[model samples]
Target: MLLTKFDPFKQFKDLERSFYNYPSNNESVNGFVPIVNTREGESAYHIDVDLPGVKKEDIKVDISKDILTISGERKTKDEIKEEDYYKVETSFGKFTRSFTLPENIDIENIEARSDNGVLEVIIPKKEEQNSKKSIEIK
Candidate 1:
């Protein structure tokens, strides 16, 4: 006997994806999706993307219309002899990820850097301005 976990909405999700031609959150159109982690701090928000085989030059970060997009491609080895490999599981393809910037973010100060195969995007929040004012009526 085999026990399997069941999800009642799995069928509905599949139907929706097929109807709308959309990829699931964990799957990308190119078939390679880099894992990402996000954190929010008092003064800034950080997004960390794990890209094992992708080079820094291949990655691109851009912002347009309040959307931050990260795109890159992972290239395979120059030559691979099929006979020499019993199994190859490495994924290679183009990948894209996007995030919507919050209204309180300081767009001008956004920064991105890559180190040890991790790409970190830092979005600094704008300092809050005191809006309280005294109004005198005649």
Candidate 2:
């Protein structure tokens, strides 16, 4: 028979690590996570991503089959002067986000725009077709 000791705080620690995206001891953190919001409208679907400090030119939107991917890089500004540092919390790195699109989406008509610090992607839905037909019986 084997015996093991159980710790009560193990679950909490695991949750904290996942929520903060803390890397493991053997891995290195490379990128930041951007907030995203998605909504479905009557005629289209909208994806809004919050990308503060990231320029429009640095962002790229791509689609492959039914997957929509948004990728970009945020560079750190060299504004540190020769003085005592208090606190630095700004994060800068490359980020990529992907979403699986529905079947009715019109890929050719999809469009994206950036205003302020938010990127909005509009995916227009395809028009519904009438497939029912009445046949005259003789």
Candidate 3:
């Protein structure tokens, strides 16, 4: 006898990825969906997001209500004609991505930098705060 476990929402997740035209290949750089990598260490969280062909001036990063947003745009050629190009796969226009930061993050200590079409953000975790309290009875 053999038993197999089934995932009820796997198909739904696949459908959602398809609906948004997410790239099938994880290493595809020309796709509309930029690849993102995140890592957590004892001191900080590191994030690397691929944003090819995007200008540094066009990129924006902000934190609002504990949500971190990274946004940018890639400009396409303006004079290219339909018959001039055989094929095109690069993604253009504005794209935005948001992430919810953990409570341990230090909002003011965050740092970001962009180099060679890749944006890197470093978020340092806040030191543990004392929560113990003594109340006097009235």
Candidate 4:
């Protein structure tokens, strides 16, 4: 049998090159779902999303059939002169994210607010089923 030598450094270099050369689509890409932390309470569910560089007019939130969708676009500045020499590494494009709310949520009472680059969504629980309680035996 013939033995072949494996070069790990060469493989890593190829991976790094590929990462830098990755293509970006001009259309919106829903790659990152917001960091969601669900807390069980007697009244409602609160969701917060970190959305820096997004303007109030550019953000859109929609709800349909128990699904909530959030989308926004961050415009890039065009202040770089032709003679300027430097590196640019900031991302500028459209992003979208969606989530399906549980059945027990009250769709009509859902509310959203944005302040200081953070978005907060409040989903009130349904009164009929969410308010029901069960007795536990010890």
Candidate 5:
């Protein structure tokens, strides 16, 4: 039988399990992880992403079926002479973020814009359906 009770400790259990699968420090990973924030409003969903030092033209946003994808590359500034740099910490590379949009979204009405290194994607929700009809008994 399936248990219907909700356990408050489930989150802690999941976090403990994740610790066992953590990546090693020596892993070779490319690109920086752009911070992303998503919020739902009364009529739409807003996705805010931070892409510092990346150009607007370099970014691409597309929707395939119900999946929304955002991709871009941050090119490193002109190569610096080996002796000219004391320390380089800024990350520059390609990065992509994708999301599976829900059925409530109005796909045709989605829009994206960028300003001051911030990208905003607005996803409008479709009007709710209310077409229930009473069937006349024979």
Candidate 6:
């Protein structure tokens, strides 16, 4: 009779199990909050977020007390019938994100749009008081 050596991969099997069986994180409960990148210019600030599998109708944008909130839900597709299965992996759920706008932003002019799974928000800056000035040299 021959004895085989123990495989090292078996030792890490529990780690793999934990990763696969872990519960959803805090973000999942808040909806599919995405990574947001903000760009500031003299005229406006632009915010971009990646949101795949989410529809325009499912998204909701609200502004209250200088706070901007974006929330949406992504519904999972129905199961496909198949005799032979190889692999399947995808995430689908709700998500919400909020941002505190600067005091100089014009909340009434804010606009948001989703294109090709990316959400873009534009916040126009408030007009500066007496921006135009004449220079006098003595």
| Tens digits of per-residue lDDT for model 1, 9-104 | 999999987977665656555667899999999999999999988899999999998999999998877797667788866667898999998899
Best model number under TM-score: 2
What TM-score do all the candidates reach, one by one? 0.75, 0.76, 0.69, 0.63, 0.73, 0.66
Candidate 6, residue 50: Cα displacement in angstroms equals: 0.7
TM-score of model 1 vs. true structure: 0.75
The TM-score between candidate 4 and the true structure equals: 0.63
Ranking by TM-score: 2, 1, 5, 3, 6, 4
lDDT scores in order: 0.90, 0.88, 0.85, 0.74, 0.88, 0.81
Off by over 4 Å in 4: 1-40, 80-85, 129-138
**Candidate 2 residue runs with Cα over 4 Å from true position:** 1-28, 81-85
Which segments of model 1 are wrong by more than 4 Å? 1-29, 136-138
Say which prediction, candidate 2 or candidate 4, comes out ahead on lDDT: 2
| Span of 10 residues, lowest total lDDT, candidate 6 | 24-33
Candidate 3, backbone clash total: 0
Weakest lDDT window of 10 consecutive positions for candidate 3: 23-32
Better of 1 and 6 by lDDT: 1
Name the better of 2 and 6 by lDDT. 2
TM-score of 2: 0.76
Expressed as tens digits, the lDDT of each residue in 67-112 for candidate 6 is: 8989888786658644344753444677778989899998888899
Best by lDDT: 1
